[model samples]
Target chain A: MRSDRQNRTPMGLKIAAAAGLAFLHLPLLLIFVYAFTTEDKSYQFPPPGLTLKWFAVTWNRPDVWDALTLSVKVASISTVVALVLGTLCAAAISQTRFFGREAISLLVILPIALPGIITGISLRSAFNLAEIPFSFWTIVLGHATFCVVVVYNNAVARFRRMSGSLIEASMDLGADGFQTFRHVILPNIGTALLAGGMLAFALSFDEVIVTTFTAGQQATLPIWMLEELVRPRQRPVTNVVAMVVVLVTFLPILAAYYLTRDGDQISGQGK
Target chain B: MPHAVTFQQVSRHFGAVRAVDAVDLEIAPGEFFAMLGPSGSGKTTCLRLIAGFEQPTSGHIEIFGETAEGVPPYRRHVNTVFQDYALFPHLNVADNVAYGLMIKGVGRAERAREAEAALEMVKLPGYGGRKPGQLSGGQRQRVALARALVNKPKVLLLDEPLGALDLKLREQMQEELKALQRALGITFVFVTHDQGEALSMADRVAVFNEGRIMQTGTPHEIYRRPQTRFVADFVGSSNVLSPDLTARLGGPRQWASLRPEDIRLDTDGHHRGRVIAASFLGSATRITLEIDGETLSVLLPSGSAVPEPGEEVAFSWSPGDLHVMGDEA
Candidate 1:
């Protein structure tokens, strides 16, 4: 009806949207193009020639494999810690009203709200003061500081949207506290936690600022990429690794978006 | 047998607000009891107290002769149909109905069979596979009812279950709920602000106001002989005649209630008034009149003559119809 006509976006707005998307993605397009370029040192327009040799070169590097292993381990461990701690914090804050609840919620999310360098420097100084050596565990702890915040943000929003009556209904239907949490609460928040965990993994995988401070002799993928850029060793190989990093991070983020877009579809809301 | 629920001067307070003030109540077993009131009138709080979602701040509560205080909701033999239905969004209809049985460690196949039976009882036999989101509002309401009833709780607490349905659906559900209660013979403690639902469905209705029960009686007794001004005014539209007007009408100088439908217009009528407005309501015409410095409403049958605005008319009711109300609480 008339709503279809009213919903038609203007040509100007459509052009603006397309231009905005292009502005953000065109640089990433360059990375894809250069990964196949034959040039080994400097970036060039249209790439003098396109070849697939960089992929094989990147695959052969032992250093690349080590960095990839470290990144996956750190991201996986950090995501696990974040999932447990973040869900606990979200459940406590969202389900109950107590003194200083708002302040506590703000403090939980403070690591992400502050500048990345600030979190990095504070974590480094704290570890040094405690006479602790920078190991893979240090990188995981640092990544977890912010990853927990990401998971907390997603979880708290979902918990607040969930109806309190659902819990009451479960309890009234003879479910104990543990049973209610397992059956009613877990299923309701399952997708949100999955999306949150994916986002946390993606964030920790590429996090370079804190990793630079916390990693002693270790090289995560991003730190390795940084070293490759500075030393200029088979430049297209770095681009090829960059292509992997983009895909590894992009798939989870895309999955998170799809998971959360239909978040308000909880059935029987306000019925 | 002991009553299904009993409240001995029970109250629930939150800081300075007494949400459910000290009040006593009793619900006989197998009775369809209704707690009717406007919002914040403590009807829902009372229902929650019975369901064990709420504990009384002071005083004792008993369920089937057992102590109710300090008992968790899961330990109580009661279930509730929440106002919003509260069907599990992640679960399909069959799983939602079988949630209680699942918690009790029922086997998968038996759970599915019982869930199907519960759905069939609610007249939704083949709807077990569909998700709650796919069903309409009324269908979700029935699913909520089925989910609660499948447990076979000693008492079923309903919190405004029909509040969200359209008029026709609400009326239909009300009859179905009444029939279900009668057939199951379980104590039903229903909470609602809709007086019509309470009047039409409950075996006994408790009218609540300001965290206290104004009156409790059979619907016919409540309609014909409201004991207080609040009950008379709230239960249905009635002309609450003050003591001054009662004296003018040759009744004792006491507060009285007169039903609109009880009065008849006739040439030999003694009481006279000027019609201020008249509105047609399909079956009857509601005539507002200015009588002795007070406004009174009278309902005339649709086929009867309606006096025009500003015209004089006389109406009278039988002496027995002029109900003298008791003193306020």
Candidate 2:
């Protein structure tokens, strides 16, 4: 009976899926092709020879290297901060029945759902009112605000899937409160935490709008790419850096998907 | 010794619903106690209160005579085997068993040694390297037992611990758990909705209804001398007759309950009834008979004379076998 449906998918669906796959991968293929182009000035197709000159140029540029290092540092710090705060919030909201809990949860997820420009503008205004200087730390703070929502969603979903009886069992087994969290609760949510951290790192690494607002003079890789795009003195080098960004960010996302795929079904079942 | 556990009129409320209401119980050291009830009868809630996962809305709980107020579950000298087993999927069997010991700061070597010993006690000595996902249902249950017992708790709480197993495995584990309790000499508080599980394993059983304890006594006392209609009906299969029908046999305002095995079905007896249905079980034959508009079920040994449906049969039971309850509801 099941096999009958398996053999009967319409031709339209197959064509649509092929189109969707091409749509997603074509831009990535273009970026890779342009990164190796010999013509260093334009984005024209079919005229440029292939060369590895942009790769060597990208490796030597001090500004690009500094921007890459800054992006990594900001992503690491923001991810850590988001993980601790998001985990605590998820644990608090998951285990207890308190007043306005649903409202608080909605508020927690609001930052990630809102437009990034709006978050950037709001953070900029807030910093102006507080009269605080903008630096690398401000960029980390800006990224963390939205990054926390991703971590919170992942962690809370994992917590909800977890059997409450496990925590109760740990406590009953002569484990202190800390011990129960360390031994039982933490182990159960470890996969979710890793997935959330990876996702948050990827998000922070590529965040451009908020980084532009918070970064006064220092540029992250994303901000540097934006600057290079507007003033195209080194177009091929920019393509090379863009390809590198895509690779670095894509690997973590794939890892996060694999880590969280099994438990993702839990939320669907919960509904 | 003082009672291993005590609940002093414990009551817990979630909003307007009382999950547990004014429950008072005392469990003795080294005794196998069972709380038997239907779903939502507060048996599991009461177990959670004792486990410190929940705090009472009123009253108090004590472990070994010390007030359990503000005492975290890890600090209390009690362990629980959860209904779902709750074995850590990330940890192998040995690490799971050693979890409680590690929490108490036991050295790695000693904790591993004790975990192995606990696994041996549960008869799963070589299963230490397997994840819970790799183990069968029965093996998982045994690992859960080993993990809890490795801590050497003063009292062990099992919340429907065998609920996930098949019937045959459930019966096997029940006997093994009872024997383990006796061998360890630790107090055990087992919760289950299955009356048979409670009756066969517990030294004493507390039958719960609604949110209160209907009765608590030795299994024989509960079965042979039920104090309420609920107790008799919940504990075992009973033919409960109203006061009007039992009035001719005894007094008014008295309901009678008779076990199926106690009622004899023969060709020559005082009371006569027509068989409505007959089911042939492997070891016994069950005949449902209607007497004076009331239905009575009789269980006779296999290979006994099988009465056809609609055939008249004589049914009677010894007067001493009848359990009578006063109008308390």
On residues B47-131, what C-alpha lDDT tens digit does candidate 2 reach at each position? 8788887888999888898999677777778888988899887789999899888877899999989999999999998888888
Prediction RMSDs, each to the true structure: 4.1, 3.6
Work out the TM-score per prediction: 0.91, 0.89
lDDT tens digits, residue span B1-329, model 1: 99999999999997898989988999999999999999999999999999888889999999999999999999999999999999999999999999999999999999999999899899999999999989999999999999999899999999999999999999899999999999999999999998899999999999999999988899999899998888889988788999888889888888999999998988799999889999999999999988878988999998998889999998899979999984441
Candidate maximizing TM-score: 1
- Score residue B83 of candidate 1 by CA lDDT: 95
Shift of residue B258 alpha carbon in model 1, Å: 1.7
lDDT of 2 at A28: 89
DockQ of each: 0.78, 0.68
